[model samples]
Target chain A: MEFINDLMQYEFLQKAFFTSIMVGIISGVIGSFIILRGMALMGDAISHAVLPGVAISFMLGINYFYGAVLMGVLAAVAIGVVTQHSRIKNDSSIGIVFTAFFALGIIFISKAQTATDLTQILFGNVLSVRTSDMWITLVIGGIVLLTVVLFYKELLVSSFDETMAQAYGLPTRAIHYLVMVLLTLVTVASLQTVGVVLVVAMLITPASTAYLLTNKLWIMILLSALIGAFSSVVGLYFSFVYNLSSGAVIVLVATFLFVLAFIFAPKQGVLWRSIRARKSKSAA
Target chain B: MTGTVSVKNLHVSYHGKEVVKNISFEFNSHKLIGIIGPNGAGKSTLMKAVLNLIPKDKGKISFAGDSVEQVRKNIAYVPQRSDIDWDFPITVIDTVLIGRYPKLGLFRRPKKSDKAFAYKCLKQVNMEEFADRQIAELSGGQQQRVFLARALAQEAEYFFLDEPFVGIDVASEKTIISILKKLRDSGKTVFVVHHDLTKVVSYFDELILINKQLIGAGPTQEVIKPEVMNKAYNIDFDLLNQMGVGV
Candidate 1:
């Protein structure tokens, strides 16, 4: 009750609340594509690779959004180039590039020693979210959602069968790079709420939970967004009431929902499968 | 809508090793053409290169008198069943509906007529009952039928299928072959990458024999001779005799 009362009274809390929910919703939306393409590790790599850009922006006295997106895209291209040109697989290339960027970021942060708590960039403090950050999140969220709605058919076909899409002259490579750019924008938008380290959790957990619950892509996306938003609300309340890290609490809530779905989803749940198996055995 | 696909000196390589070596063949429209080769032969590579799915080292693939780009929308391809992730979260109808994407282009959704056409394609394959079911719940034959239905839904002038008969049930193979024959009879060109030499005489009107090179390409009777089989397979020609391939 007090948390709700404080939310109504406080402006910063309102910004934080709204921003986190937007982050949650957008994360779920883009995460659906990421997981479906089997690019979960790419999400992780891009999120971590953004740290160097964040640090550079801080040192240069500019917003990290521009730097973060630039570095994320560059890292994605680098990973692609490496995997394509060599015998090394995609996961290895992602590991090499993201770690190099992350190490550079750590060195820059320690050397520059900015007045702001840089720790917040690593582990988010949603309570201190600015008005500008909130607006940026909302705008990015709108663009990401709108893009998905407009290109639903292309994304579905290209992701499902690359050769077929190519035969149809769909420019599958361009579609892949488009998704990569959207991922970069999403990662940048998520920084204020979940930060760099936990952003992938926000991205994948709700989507995975939704995956277990539904067999349709649109339904999974819808359920994922709802789960993500619900987690944000509950996570924010708990973090506000108790002096806890908002990012950590939000990730935990999303994970808990995944656990519930994993055990109880009607068609896919392990428990239900076991019961169905036993029934069939007895009947036989 | 009938057209010919002519390959002029087509050469494709992978990882600096040539998979298809200086091969060339012209496939006529209004016929069922089979690409026959050994296990490691470049039948699939040839199809992919012709479709521009993979990079060709050197080649000219022309549909009718136009380049591939000019006639891309009129071409439809179904890759091997093993190439797909069957567990992907998609309904049979939605999978079939993807065939309309080229016509719909960007920024446009499928209209009611498109859906009806997709359903008709599924009906042609006798898979209309499984329209709403998830793709993973299907048997191998049913899955092949679904893919064939998707290709049918494209309504293209040219169709390329990679091993559509491999690992499928007899009923599905019959259904798919009959559909292909019907399409061919309607003056649409159909190319299938087939491995079973036993069915070569019965399934295809024309055959392209290859083992990294074009051994022969003509009517089934002329191309499936003992000498051409020896050149492509390097196997005992007696096996062809035993299989009653009309060699």
Candidate 2:
């Protein structure tokens, strides 16, 4: 009891816990849309693409979040433009741009004299989150959540049928760009809590698991956010006790939830549907 | 119902090659017009040009004595089923709701009344039961019905359908034809880009035949004579007769 109380008293641990919860909520909400749009790999690509931006920002003594968000949005626009204007497939464009940027980031990091711990960028240490980063995460997450709710109907229409949305004069191009911007914001906000490597997992897994359980978009969003928050808290607790990386543990917990949802979700899940089909066939 | 569509000296190209030569036509409301042509004859291009879905090299199209942008609300278009991604994660209900988007305008949600109207349109097409089902799970025929239901929800005075009956079951084809006829009867102009010649005589009130240019157009029975069919299709009538599409 005294040890648990003592752990709670530490400022860094409390800051990390609060930051992880905020990151989880934000990633969960935005990630639901990302998963629905099948942009999971794109999210991963953006995370990697932001590394060069971060390295350059660090060298220039600038705020890394701004640099990350800027480059993330640029990467998204490049992918969108390349896929739409060129004959190349979208995944190929993503792979090309992300790998190239990531390679440049690695070069920049290796050449730097300061030699900041590379693991801090690759796999985040949640215990190191400063109060400023926590505040930034909360503010950005709040803005993203508000924007999503405000443009819910428009986003839903455009995501479901972009051509039809354009035919009806819905400004689908603007919506497409807006979605990319929002995705960049979510990716940057998640950097401190989950690191660049595992952030995409948080953005994709919870929503995908929720998708298997519900057909309603609103319900899916709510469920994803809840699942994400639950995973963050549990993962944080487990890591505190067992001395594991919190970000990786959180992602693993989310993945486990996804596996469970895949197997056991009522109507759309694999196991339940198979069993129901067998039972009906035998009855017939 | 009194609107007239006029296309003057329209020329269209795809990838720098002129596909639809100088063509002109005037169509009025309440008429069921069929655009017929052989494969690669630019019938679809002309229709798209009229809708402003494609850019014309040279032309002026006026709808109801106004430009397309000025009178956009009066037109509704149904694209070919193949043009859409069927794997899109949307329900039949949401698909029909998109038709109401143009009517709802910006920053406005589909209200209770709009949703009720959408349900009524679905019921008209006998697709009310599948409202919540994912569009990808539906068969080709059901998909066509859903698109038709969306058109019905649009409530436009002018409608365009591109090969709506392609790959659909006979019953679905009959249902679509009946619905289109009802639209015509109610004084809404409808243009159908159709391929089947056998049903042209009975299905359309008027026909416009095309082969890179306007061939002939008039009442179906008059426009479908051997000479006109040959000019539009670029095939001898005897050859079509041999293939069992009687002249």
Candidate 3:
């Protein structure tokens, strides 16, 4: 009761809760696409790659979000262009860029000797969320969610069948680039609440869990957002009570949900399939 | 009448080796042509070259008397089933809805009329029931039907399908043939890259026998001669005749 009272009274905690809800919705929706396209690792790569960009901007006294977004977009485009134009495989290209950027960020952080800022950027301190950050995340999340819904058909077709989309005279290349850009925005926005290390979990876990339960894309998006929101709230409360890292707790909760879904989901789950097979065999 | 599609002295290379040699052909809007060749014959590469999907070293392709870019909207292509990832999380209805994307322009959503058209295309392919089902849940034949439905939804006058009949069941093969026939009947020019020599005679109205260069082309019966088969398949003409695939 005391911890609950503390959570309700703290302005920073309120901001964290509100901002996480907004970021959860955005990450959940976009993350569905990322998982379906097998770009889960790519999302992780972008999140890590933005570290150097954020570090450089912070050192130069620029806004961290702006720096992160710019670098994230550049990294995504570089990966896309390099993989498409050159002989390098997609995974290798992502690995190369992400490692280089992350290493540079670590070196820069060590040089600056700003331990508190670096720790916050990497691990996140969600209790420090400001009203400005909350409002920005909300606005950006709303725009991204609306755009995704509006262009749902185009994205589905391009992702499923690129050649056919091209043959129909659809600008598949443009859509591909646009999707990468949107992913970068989502990653940068999410970093504020989930931090860089755990952003990939927020981006992938809910969607992957929803994917195991449903085949319809729209339903998957909705369900994923709900699950993400639920995890965020629960994890926030637990962190407030236990004095744990909010982002880590949230990701751990999501991963637990994912494992549960994997084992017990109706159509595709391991336990469900095993029971189904046993029943059929007994009947035979 | 649209401008002619002319390919002159085209050469296609992949990884620094020539896959398709210097070849030239012209197609207009009046015929349904079948590109017939054995595997590794570079038929797909030639088609891709015309579409600028693959780079060509020394070729000029002009469409309907216009450049490839000028008439990009006038062309439609259907890739093989193996080319797509069927496990992708999208409904059959949504897949068909993509046909309207080019016409919808960027940042614009599909309107009601566009969805209605998509439904109509699904009905045409006898796949309206599977519209809401995820693509991975569909059978191979049904998957092919959905691809055909997507192509039909494109409503483009010129259609190219690469190996449409591969791995499909008998019923699907017949359905696809009828669909192709209907497209031809409606005055849409269709080009099919087909492999099965057994059904060549009954399936295609016109034939293009290709082995690096145009071996023979005309009506099906005229193009399926001994010399053409020998040249295109590099097989004994007598063997092809014994198998009832060549004259």
Candidate 4:
């Protein structure tokens, strides 16, 4: 209860709270498409691949956002090129490219001797989010969220049916690259809240939970964002009261929601499926 | 431009292997045309190449005597049913509304008229009742009709479908063919990759027969000759030869 009230008393706590919520909203909204397109592994790949970008950015004393975004987009493009040019499938391409980038990141960090801690980069320090970081999250999150809004229809068709989108002269390839770019932006925003390793989970879990609840894409997106934000706020409280890692607790809360949806969602859940199965058995 | 499509000396290869080699045919007349071939005959590949969905190793596809680029807006292609992931969470209304996407212009959602038109297409395909349901929950035939509705919403002059009848219910097949016939009668050129030979004469006004290269193409009655049939199927058309027109 005291933790919940800390928002009114502590300005830093408020910054952490708002930053995590913004992170949740971005994750939920963009993650809907990621899960819908079966790009979970791709999300995982891009997040992991951003490490090298961060390391280089730290080494060069540049804003980490620029480097991470650059690296993430490059990694995505590399994955696309590899899959398209070779016999290697998408999953294998992602695995090969991301791991190499990640290895390079490790090497860069080891040699740089910079103050940028590897553990901090890998696992974020959400509790220490400054006012400036909060503003950065807001700007980045707003841009991506607005982009998603502007291109909702384009993204829908291209993601749902690329061939058909192409038939319409929709520039499917360009749209694909644009999606990768936005994903990179989203990943960079997430890096401060959930760190690199847990970023994909934040992106995928809430969307997946919403997917279990609804068949409509818009509804699923709405549900996902709401669930994501709720989890963030609740997780922030839990972290405050228990002195737990905010990022880890946030992810756990999101996963808990997913588990709840998986078991008990009315539209398509294990419980409902079993109930339907048993009803058929009784009828027979 | 009015509906007409021409494929000239088209060659498609994958991994250094020729899938479709030296195929050329001119299809006009704004009529329903069936592209029939045995499995692995590159029928699907031919459609994909013509639509520029797959890169053709060599050759040109023209529409209305122009390169495909100028007339691309007039064309709509529905790939095979198996090519899609049905489990994607999109409602039927939205799926059909995607047909309007090409016409929707930039940064525009489906407008009121688009919604009405999508609903109208659903009605035409007798799928209006299922518009709100998730597409994956529907049966195979219903799913095919939903795709057809989407294509119809495109309002294109040239329609290309890969196996519209494969693995679908008879009612859906009938509905789809009727819709195609209507489109043709309304002066839209329709091209389909078809497999069933027995119903060829009944379904299409023209037939494009192929193995890898073009075997014969023209009015269905004139092109289903025994030699052409033999060339396409690698079997003596003796059985079809006995039915009169094969010879």
Candidate 5:
């Protein structure tokens, strides 16, 4: 009740709340495709790759979104180039590129003259989210959701069977690059809420939890978005009451939901499988 | 429309190794063509190169004088079962609906007619009962049927299947071979990359033997000779006799 009153009273709280919700929804939506495509490591790479750009933007007295998105896309392209041109596998390429960018980001952050808080960028301080960041999050969120709706079929086919998709002239490579771009934009939008380090949790945990609950792609996506939004709201409330970091709290809430679903999902849960096994065994 | 495919001097390499070397063949309509070879003989590679699914180092492939791009919608490919991720979150009907994507093009949703047609294709493969089931919930034979149903939904003129008989039950193999025969009788072209040499004479009307190159291409009776089988598989006639081939 007090949180609701404060949410009504304070403009910063309103911005943070709305921004977090948008971040949650878009992360869950795009994250569904990422995990389905087996690109969860790519998602983590793009999020971490945003850090050097954020530090550079702070050094240049500019908004971090532009730099962060640019770095994210560059990192994605570099990973693609390395994997395609060399014998190195996708996971190794992602690890090598992301860690280099992360080290560069640390160097840039230490040399920054301004009093930019690295902790906030690492773990997010959503309470101090700028108004412009909120607006940017809304725009990115809208683009991600719209693209998913328009390209759901293509995404589904390409992820499920790339060879068939390519055989049917679907331009599977182009679709892959487009998804990478969307991941970059999603990483940029999520920076103000979950920050760089914990954004993958926001992207992956909710979708994985939803995966346990459903067997259809559309239903999984919808449920994942809902779970993400719910976690964000509840985490924000708890963060406010306890004076905690909003990003960490939100990630914890998402993880908590995942735990619940892991044990109790109706069909795919471990407990459900055990119960079915016992029943069959008794019948035998 | 011309219902023939011609390939001249086709070459396909993987990771700088030539898997399919200087292969060329001509396929006519209304025939169930079998691509038969030993393991690592580039049978799948040749099929993929012909379908333009993978890049060819040097090749001139024409579909009745039409380019692959011009007739892509008319082509349907069923890759090996191992290539698919069965645990993916998709329903059987939805998987079949993917075939209609080529006809629907981009930015358009599947309509009632499309759904009805997908159901019809499912029924054709006797998989309509499993339409709503998740793909992972299916048996190996059921999964292959679902894929065949998806190809049927494509309403394609040319069907390319790679190792369709591998890792499937005898019932599935019979069902799939019957479907291919039916399609061939309807004047559509069907190509199967088959590893099982015993079923070659019964399953296909024509055979294209390859050992990283074109060993022979002719009627099944002519291509299944002892010398040709020896050249393609590099094995003795005694072993071929053991595999139930009366060569």
Candidate 6:
């Protein structure tokens, strides 16, 4: 009770709460499409691939956010180009590009003139998110949400059934790139909270949990956003009371919810499925 | 129902080897056509090329004397059922509502009238009750019915279905055939990639028999002859005789 009252008193805690929730919502919304399209790993790749851009941007005395977003988008484009031009396939292409960019980021960090904190960039310090960073997250989150609303039908049709989208002349290639761009934006937005190593978790877990619970895309999306926001707010509370890493706490909370859904989701859950199976067998 | 599809020297190649080699045929609307062949005989390749879904190495495909791009809106394709992710989280109505996407263009949401039209299509296929159901939960035949409803909602003049009968219940098959027949009767063009030989005469008005190339194409009775069968499929002589193809 005291913790709840104190949470409102600390401005940093307030910033942490708002930023984490927004990140969760953005990631969870785009994450639904990411998981459904089987691009969860691609999301991971883009997140990791942005590291080099961040380091280079720091070296250039510019906002690392721009550099990180640019690199993320470039990595997406490069992955597409590699898969299209080579027989290595998509997963392999993602592996190659991300590792390469990540290595370059590490090297850039080591060679940088400034004292770069790898841990901070990798795991994020959500409690320390500046007001400017909060504004960045807010603007980007609003843009992503708006774009998703405007193209909800296209994304749903394209991600659910690419062949049908192509047949409908829906500009599926453009839709593919649009998804990549949205993913990049979400990753950039999430960098302050979950960082690169775990942003994919935020993008995948809540959406996947909702997926196990609902059949309708809109419901799934809504449920995912709710779960995301819930986890962030709760996780931030725990982080403050327990003095733990805020980013890790947020991701752990998302995963915790996923585990709950995996084991307890109605009709589709593992425990229910087994229980039903046992009942049918005994009756037989 | 208002155009013709003409393919001239259509060819599709992958990795420098031709999958569909030198195929040419033309057909007008208001007919039900079947493309049949043995596995790996480019039956899908040919159909996709006609719609320019696949890159054509050497060909000209035109619809109603215009390029395929200009008339693509009139053509709707129902891909093979197995090709889709059935586990996708979408209701049947929304699945059918995708048919309105082309008409809705890039930025618009599906209007309420679009939902009503989708509901009507679901009713046509006897799947309105399952409109809110997840596609994954439906049986194979029901899933096929949903795809058909989606195609129907497109309101296209020419419909191309890939293996619509594969893995479907008898009732659904009958419903699909009757729908195709009705569409044909109403002067729309319906092209189905089918494998069942016994019902060709009853199901399709014309046939495009292929084995990596165009072997024969004409009215079912004329195209299903033994000479064409020999070219299209290396089946037993007795089976050909049973099929009543004249040797």
Per-residue alpha-carbon lDDT of candidate 2 for residues A1-284, written as tens digits (9 for 90 to 100): 64467467988778778888878887888888887777889989999889877887788887788888888888888888888777789999999888888898888877654444667788876778889888888888889988988888888867765655555557777887788888888877777767889989999999888888877777888899988888987787777778788889999999999999999998778999999999999999
Task: Assess chain B of each prediction and give its TM-score.
Answer: 0.96, 0.95, 0.93, 0.95, 0.96, 0.95
Summarize candidate 5's per-residue lDDT along B220-246 as a digit string, tens digits: 999998888888877896775878755
Instruction: State which docking tier applies to candidate 3.
Output: medium
Model 6 spans > 4 angstroms off: B236-239, B242-247
Model 5 lDDT at residue A224: 92
Highest-scoring model, DockQ = 5
Worst 10 residues of 6 chain A by lDDT: A109-118
Listed models, DockQ each:
0.84, 0.35, 0.59, 0.80, 0.87, 0.77
| Model 6 quality (TM-score) | 0.97
List the candidate 1 regions with Cα displacement exceeding 4 Å. Answer: B239-247
Alpha carbon deviation, residue A1, candidate 5 (Å): 1.3
Docking tier of model 4: it is medium
Q: Check candidate 2 and list the clashing pairs.
A: none
Q: Write the per-residue lDDT of candidate 2 for residues B4-56, one digit (tens) a residue.
A: 88889999987678999988888888889999888898988888888776789
| Alpha-carbon TM-score of each model against the true structure | 0.98, 0.88, 0.93, 0.97, 0.97, 0.97
Better of 2 and 5 by lDDT: 5
Which ranking of candidates, highest DockQ first?
5, 1, 4, 6, 3, 2
Clashing residue pairs in all predictions, respectively, total 0, 0, 2, 1, 0, 0
Model 6: per-residue lDDT, tens digit, B116-139?
A: 999999999999998888888899
3 against 6, candidate with superior TM-score: 6
Q: Which residue runs of candidate 2 sit more than 4 Å off their true CA positions?
A: A1-8, A111-116, A280-284, B7-24, B35-60, B65-67, B72-74, B82-90, B136-139, B208-219, B231-235, B242-244
Would you give me the overall lDDT of model 5? 0.90
Better of 3 and 4 by TM-score: 4
